[model samples]
Target: MKALIRSSAAVSAFILALSSSGVLIAQAATTGTTTTPTPMTSTATSDLTAGPLTLTAVPSFDFGTATLTGTTGDKVPGSSVTGALKVTNPGQIGGWQVTVAGTPFTDTSGTALTGTILSLDGLATNPITADDSTNTSTLPTFVTPETISTSATVVESAAPSTSTSHIGIGSYTTSYDAAASSLAVPSSTVAGTYTSTLTWTMSNAPA
Candidate 1:
């Protein structure tokens, strides 16, 4: 069999003489490398196990320190914490919800801010991921302007998912603005450092 030389060298063939069997004999010289193709295949596989459907991050509220003017005032200014409430879904076949409750604001001396309330306004859902393939409709639902109290109130929720459909199958984030996050001080309020505790809970909840 004859094969073509595929290299950067010149090939030459010269007729030398005739063979004893009445066949023409030739001499050939070739330089450089000859290449032959060999096929190669690669295989790879992966199994995606289920991940936990839960809250990934919860923002800490810091209404900071406030000073009282020796008289009755509606609200007082305080510091702010920068963050957003975050939740993640593991493609679970169930729904989920997040609730928030807060204890009354009190001073170091246990003096409660009786009529004071902590509120978050301009509440809304934000896109958790910037992936172009993410579906915007699957983000979680939320209730806005929450005046977090002692009772657990649902702030964000998601509908149940089925075998073929998903309501909240991706990560979600809730954005809230500081509208009026201050404590009210009455004329009788004792001037001192005050603090409050906020509790955020996540659980499995269906539509």
Candidate 2:
């Protein structure tokens, strides 16, 4: 009986040892550690471009103050003086002309100059007297008074055209080619401070 009891206790001890060893082996297990990798991505995206344009104008001629150097109201009857006029385009351009205009002139005494009509409608016509008859006789008269006595021609783009004695606007334009211009004071330019002025106007062409 004693030996049997001893053998039983030994058997019990061996079983307990086996169970504890199995528990330790299971608890000490090292799990394989892994982290899920994160994915990376990206997204991307295009137009027309152009250049700049520009114009400028400049007057080539300037007529300084014109004073009558001849005798008072004693201008040559049929002789003319020449002067220059300049026109320019600073930028690339095409098709343009200059037209001139102005107010009539008067004497230093503030008297409007007067003269007989030499022509009308491009023909000989009766004399058109001055508005202020006080100045009418101021104009020179001839024994054989022609239908037209005095005239003015504003030369530009070409030789000036003759105009009957009067106070009004006179204009001219440049020829086909863009060029400088000149004007011929009428041979019969009356004496006095003829306050005639020139103005330049621009245009594409005859409308």
Candidate 3:
């Protein structure tokens, strides 16, 4: 009986030792456990700028040579010329204007041609054309020379974003049709080459 009891005690001691070993192994596994994570981010931006108002002169007027045949006090043979002006208004909210001034026709000897008249026709923001007196649709005439001349509303742009008729921010062109007439060539009129100068000015202010 005593030997049987001793054998039962030894079995119980072995079972308890096995349970302790399992618990120690579980604690060792948990001690080295760890985790980590990283965060990310980003950013963005934008900017807008306005452009400047500017003007550019295009081709000049060239009145080809002509021979005078009319009697004194009568209009003589003359020529007509064509030219243009270009304007750029980037982001402009208002309208603009263009003016033209011409010097008197003079010879190299500084002799001014008297009784001469210059006429401007087909003054428009688009392609310019000479005015036909017979056609009332043509532009007005500028008889007085050497003066700052303004045409009808060349560019009627609408207020910015207020109306669909406003001129946009971009380049615009204006063409001019011009004609010149010489007053009667005096019987004593000299035979020589003549020349003149035309100056163009532009402004944001309405004319």
How far is each candidate from the true structure, as Cα RMSD in Å? 11.3, 24.1, 11.6
Order of candidate numbers by lDDT, starting with the best: 1, 3, 2
User: Candidate 1 has which clashing residue pairs, if any?
Assistant: none
Q: Model 2: residues >4 Å from true position, as ranges? A: 1-83, 90-94, 116-192
Clashes of each: 0, 4, 2
Model 1 TM-score is: 0.63
Candidate 1 or 3, higher TM-score?
1
lDDT values, one for every candidate: 0.65, 0.33, 0.51
> For residues 38-88, what per-residue lDDT tens digits would candidate 2 score against the true structure?
999987632322211111222233223444444333322322223323333
77-154: candidate 1 lDDT, tens digit per residue: 435657777777766658888898878878877877776666665333442331236564465666765677788888
- lDDT by residue (40-147, candidate 3, tens digit) is 888887665657767655536555665665456544433544445565665555555556666767899999776554444434333433232332222212222222
The order by descending TM-score is: 1, 3, 2
Q: Give candidate 1 misplaced runs (Cα > 4 Å).
A: 1-49, 64-73, 122-137, 162-165, 180-188
Best by lDDT: 1
lDDT of 3: 0.51
